[model samples]
Target: MDTLSKLFKNNIRQYGMIIALVVIMLLFEILTGGLLLKPINITNLILQNSYILVLAIGMVLIIITGHIDLSVGSIAAFVGAAAAIMMVDWGWPTWAAVVASLVVGGLIGAWQGFWVAYVRIPAFIVTLAGMLLFRGLTMIVLEGQSISPFPSGFQKISSGFIPDFGSFGTNMVAVVAGIILSVVYIINELRDRRAQLKYNFKVISQGMFLLKLILLVAVINVFTFMLASYSGIPNILILLFVLIVIYSFVMNKTVMGRHIYALGGNEKAAGLSGVKTKKVTFWVFVNMGVLAAISGLIFAARLNAATPRAGTNFELDAIAACFIGGASASGGIGTVFGAIIGGLVMGVLNNGMSLIGLGIDWQQGIKGLVLLLAVAFDIYNKNKRSV
Candidate 1:
């Protein structure tokens, strides 16, 4: 019975996100008069929260190490300004401008990381300083004006979707390929379960495991059908999927990823055990910088312009999503999947509130209440465990 109780606790810690997502979906569905789960809104939810989810993944890693980055929104703003200047003022090619923007963002991250990791500055102080510094630079670059009319190809980075293979009469070949891919994915998952059991790792019950697998498969097929029914899927969505897969693998399978988690869990212990905390911290910021640059580019593309205020309050959204999704404020406790779920919850809340004709003030008020409740619940859960 104790073991069962432990299992339940573990599942809640690990899968609280999935539960929250279902509850939010149900609530929104009812609130929207059943409009919340319309296929289009579901797809819009994914696309709209894409940037927040991306930032939260990196932010959670930073927080795991007991650090917070208050400067990402500013960094994103700076990137937007720089990208605008590159294409408009400097007349750089679209690809060159994109690469340059990312590099500049990385340098900015490296600058901040150096101070925090090597100079031994507290992260909060260093990032606070960066927030002010970068915001100032952004205003200088933009000179209080917005930039627009980027090259056509550049604009496509955010706004373009993949062409429908079904446009040529429902390309049957793609359907067959998808089925084969689905089968392979299922087999791989089953093999992973077998491997875990063979190693005597704690595993979910067979019934629970099967249920999860089926649900995942169902979700995938439903998404595929939606795209197949429309103008195929989005290229940006495909790229996002690739990135998530790669990052997930890095976090779950690679040595560097292990070290990051270790450092987050206990910095002194990680350092004593030969993990290079300095290099890890530096690169974590670098990764965050790159993701921020990409997000800025996407935002610019979506708006068809780069505004001076493009990223205002974005960091708050990302941080809130991370915390709401189960990342502890004290750090060393979060997951990529959880962060994604959290972003979705926020996205759903925003969409549903807007649909219900709630004013911005009311929406913000409700969101603040939700954030307070989520964090309070987190603290209570931790205390209960300690007791």
Candidate 2:
């Protein structure tokens, strides 16, 4: 009982948001009269929020390092415009255009990074300037117009699904993939438990661990089943899953990750401890730029057009997701998985309200409230820890 209490208290924030997410879904499910969880609606939910999720993944890392990128929305818009121009106007292959756009994104990140790291400018100021700069560049590139009807292959990046092996009612691919993911998750958990035991680290009891594994596996399989019932797995979902796994691993297990946390915790202390604070900050923004570019491409493909005003208010969504997911406003604390949850929370809220005939005005007010409460929760936790 003591151990359970300790675990619950230690993970209240993590568990709290998760519980909140489930509750929100249930409330919406009840209100929407089952429309919220229908397979088709579920698929639409994923598709509509994929870009924000992408930005949140990258934005979490930035926040972890005690910085924010106000320019990501504009960067995404700019990259989408550049890619559209390459493919639509210059007649470049879709693959080449995408690669070039990503590189361009990296350069843009590097540009902002240089100012923040080397020049010691505040990230807020630098990225705020970038927001204006890139938004203008996006307009110039598109000549204040929308570009459309990209190549079929380019469009598939956002709208295509994994191939169905048969015309059967259920998609065998999704079902099989779910099983594989469940097995992988279980095996990974077991291995981690063994490692903890070897290191004399605190570990959950076998019963609880097993229960967790079972619950998580059930959820995973159920989610996949829903997808299978719809149009099978989306290609963009595969992209998101791969990115989450990779970023989660990188942040949790890498030396670079350690450096980032240390830097965010205290810059002077980290520098004295032999950390390259400038380099890490630079790289983090570069990564953000790349992710923004990918998100931009996906967004444009989804809309089948690139507009001058694309990506408006995107930075707010990404920033809100990070904070809502438990990233500290002051930094040095966050997780990739947490950011994903936050994005999903926003996604569900938007989808649910829209489904229930809510107006955009009310939706904005509610989202603002959610974000405020989340940050307040964080502050409460911080004060409690200090006490």
Candidate 3:
């Protein structure tokens, strides 16, 4: 009984976002007459939530460090506007626009990092000022207008998909690739388990591990088959997949990642213990700025345009996703997977409500209530356990 209770607690801590995802899906699935899980909707959900998921991952790290970034949306708008101005207005190459946007994002981050890390201003104050500053900059750059008709290659950033394997009706290439991926996944899982055992960490039972593997394989195969049936998969989905792998690796395997975790857990202690707190914090915001820029560029690409209101309220969506994903408000706890799950939750809600023809006002009200409940639950759970 004690072991079971411990297992439950552990699962809650580790997989609360997953549980919430399932609950939300069920609620919407029932409400929307099973529209939520349609394969098309599923694919759309991934695409629609991709940017927020990206931002949430970075935001999770930021919040884990007991800081918040309010300027991401504005930064995104500015970056998108810059990308558009460079590509369309100035006739720069798409690649040039992309590189410049990312660089500018990093510089903007560094600018804010200067204040937060060296000047010792609170992150909230610095980013709040940044929010206002960047928004004004965006408007100035665009001069109260929108830019459009970007190059085709640039437009493909968000709208392009990989080649369809289903066109061949049982394309051997996709099947072979799927098999290879499954084998690689199994090997990696085994190696991870062995490493955990070697380090004397608590390892799950082989049965449970295999069960998880089987479920994971099932989901992957189903998804692969569906994509192969449609247009193989989206290029942006592939980008997101690569990012997940890279960020997951950084968080789990790298010394830098360890420093991030430590800093988040306790800044003063981490600083005293030689974690280079200022540099890490600076880099954290820098990374966030880069991602926000990337997000902005993608959003602009999707619309084939940039507007003054581009990315309006996007920071709220990203931060809400992070909090909903189970990152502690006080800091020091979160995961990439959790952020993705949370982003999907919001995306699904938005999509499902739209499918049911909920007006914008009602949708916002509903989402606001849900957000409130989620945060309230998190706080209540924290206090309850403290007692």
Top-lDDT candidate index: 2
* Best candidate, TM-score: 2
Writing each residue's lDDT as its tens digit, candidate 1 over 172-286 gives 4335545665787899999998999999987777887788778877776765665554445555676677777787788889998899888888889999999999999988888
Per-model lDDT = 0.80, 0.94, 0.84
Arranged by lDDT with the best first, the candidates are 2, 3, 1
Worst 10 residues of 1 by lDDT: 165-174
Give the C-alpha lDDT of model 1: 0.80
Q: Score every model by TM-score.
A: 0.93, 0.98, 0.93
Residue 387 lDDT, candidate 2, scale 0-100? 100
Question: Per-residue CA lDDT of candidate 3, range 86-191, in tens?
Answer: 9999999889889999999999999998899899999999999999999999999999999998999988778887654434674444455567778889899999
Give the runs in model 1 whose Cα sits over 4 Å from its true position.
Answer: 1-6, 168-181
lDDT of 2 by residue, 201-313 (tens): 88778888888998999999999999999989999999999999999888889999899899889989999999999999999999999999999999999998999999999
User: Local error of candidate 1 at 297, Å?
Assistant: 0.9
Error of 1 at 220 (Å): 1.7
Candidate 3 versus truth, CA RMSD in Å, comes to 2.2
